[model samples]
Target: MSLPRNLCHGTLDEIVERGGLTEVTGADGGPYLELVSSAFPGGQAPVGEARVFTGDSIAKVVYVGLAVPQIGLDSHMVFAFCPADVAVPHFTLDSVQGQGTYAFHLDLIPRADLGTHLPYLDWAHTPLDATYEEVESRPGLMKTAIGPRQFAMMSPWMLVHRAEDEAFRGISDAVKAYLDHWFSLVEAGVPAEVVADVADTDLAARDARNRTNVFSPDVDKVWAQVERLIGHEQTEAVRGLLLDNCPPEVSA
Candidate 1:
């Protein structure tokens, strides 16, 4: 399938322009990024390997790749981790398009109770209200496709949908708006001393949430194919790099 060009890379470039980022290498001995995957036929290598970006207020890792025409796989992921003590939400965006359909999930995942935090919720969600309203008004567009297990990790502002061309542009616009909002929150994040006191608790909670939501049963489906292409050891390494979030060998 012919997908949108530079959609994910271009967005990341905008974020990079907002602040300086230090590059981190991956286990593959290359830049901690993969431009494309060579594991499958016609995979076209990912836009690049997974890249990690860190700044004062936030740290992010992103991966963008075209579909494996052989198995119908195409997707991009962005996972941004904020200072633990900041009390702000973490950002998660996953976009998958293939087989004549698309699934997009974007959220400012709450670290604690969203219901009790009206001010933060309002600040985070109000910007996308119009976009949400438009999406909800459409038929068969808005969805709860994240599955029940991952629902608790999402905020009320979460956008999960099966988008069509009519709704795609609006969704994309909302993504950009949300990204800007998240960057602002990162810039105005809590002090480092506060983060130091709560770093352990915060990171533990984030890791637990990621283990539940980011590492899904569905991932095994993809891994089945990956193992066949790359073999067991390489597949395990890739899975660890992509889904584990905080590997034990590395300090958080």
Candidate 2:
């Protein structure tokens, strides 16, 4: 079977184009895509990294790709970050393909407590719920493989499933629908005055929550491998960009 390169890059292209995001150079003087040669065990192949875009809406993206020969370990992660002021959900798509099995975890993660934020949930949650149900009703799709801790960061509409041939088209359609809905949220974002009214403590807590999600143990394991291959400085640079370390004061 041919490699499903489109599963990663094609989706990213659609996101950038639809969102009208512009490409920007990352702090490392590269276009967000760093070549990490030591990412694979035994230094077999260089991982292709691409930031894709960092737009005026304060949305940032990172794409990591690895294809190891013979062992058939091909994986990709596309993480999209929105600023705290936007109060919109951040997007994450993680997929691993190996030995004729495909695993997927895709969601628009909420930055705050979904249960308490009725307005936010009202604005975004319903569509996600409908989509999740539609996908769940399909045959041969396994439930999402996430634990309770991870579940806390996700909205009620997250899609986590495993499948063989059936997964490819189903996941592609879900990605398109979810992203279109998210782009609408970006388009109809809160007014500046409303954003200004948001309490500092609220913003700080949101930042903390986002950081916790990004710096999870699973993420750390991946970083450790990258650090071992690329060294501390480069690894930290990638982490900072992905997590967006800019202080709220500075951002404002």
Q: Write the per-residue lDDT of candidate 1 for residues 126-186, one digit (tens) a residue.
A: 6668766766687647584545545665676788787776565456676787788877766
The TM-score of candidate 2 is 0.79
Give candidate 1 misplaced runs (Cα > 4 Å). 1-5, 26-30, 33-48, 64-66, 138-144, 190-213, 216-239, 242-252
Cα lDDT tens digits, model 2, 24-87, are 6556556554556655457635555656566655467766665655456567777777775567
Off by over 4 Å in 2: 1-4, 25-31, 38-44, 191-201, 218-236, 245-252
Minimal lDDT window, size 10, model 1: 243-252
State the lDDT at 196 in candidate 1: 45
Per-model TM-score on C-alpha atoms: 0.71, 0.79
Task: Give the Å error, residue 169, model 1.
Answer: 3.8
Q: Using alpha carbons, what is the TM-score of model 1?
A: 0.71
For candidate 2, the 10 contiguous residues with the lowest summed lDDT are 243-252
lDDT of candidates 1 onward, in order: 0.59, 0.66
